[model samples]
Target: MSNFVTLLVEDDALQREVLADVLKDEGFEVLECTTGEAAELIIASTGTELQALITDHNLAGKMSGTELAHFARDRHPHLNIVIMSGTTVKPMPVGTAFLQKPFSPERLLDMVRE
Candidate 1:
């Protein structure tokens, strides 16, 4: 168990599992969710406990990662936001970060560590 709690929202099952595994291995307690809406519920119920939010830009459900991040930020102002997108370069919001797809696990860890 780790002190940091990370929320991972990725609709792709395989990607989600692999990434979640990586975070787990790094001692991060990760809460996995398939959609932005699902993640929203977790954020609502467990706001202060969440230290970070890592989400896919193009989610399977109605909401995008941008929306989720904004909502989470509103609730948890200090939330560490990481947006992963393969389609195009997403505009980085205030106090948020971006990681283009096909990035290495090392890079991901580096961002979270920062």
Candidate 2:
């Protein structure tokens, strides 16, 4: 089993559960949250212990996933970030990845493990 720790932020419960299950099945430790605010707190508290962050661009809070990604990048320069959205997202933060909605678990795994 891998020791990689990943943070997954998605407001949709079903989507969150599915992705979390997939990641956990693959031996990755997954932290899940429903809003950008919560995710920010986790990021701040966890520091570099978090290896990856996968979040939806349009989140439930004032801070969007893109904003969270930028915040995370500022703190954890080497953290892997994946922003997910059905619509096109322009100008994603530097050094972050984008995963479109309806993507396969394998694709997500690839991005996380990349």
lDDT of 1 at 28: 97
lDDT of 1 by residue, 8-105 (tens): 99999999999999999999999999999999999999957788999998898899999998898898998889999986745656788898899999
Per-residue error (Å), model 2, residue 33: 0.5
Cα deviation in Å at residue 79, candidate 2? Answer: 0.4
Runs in model 2 lying further than 4 Å from the true structure: none
Models 1 onward score TM values of 0.94, 0.96
Q: Per-residue lDDT for 1-114 in model 2, tens only?
A: 477899999999999999999999999999999999999999999866799999999999799999999999998999999999998888899999999988999999999998
Candidate 1 Cα deviation (angstroms), residue 31 = 0.4
In model 2, the worst 10-residue window by lDDT is 41-50
Model 1: ten consecutive residues of lowest lDDT: 87-96
Listed per candidate, the RMSD to the true structure in angstroms reads 1.3, 0.9
Candidate 1 residue-wise lDDT at 61: 87
**Cα RMSD of predicted structure 2:** 0.9
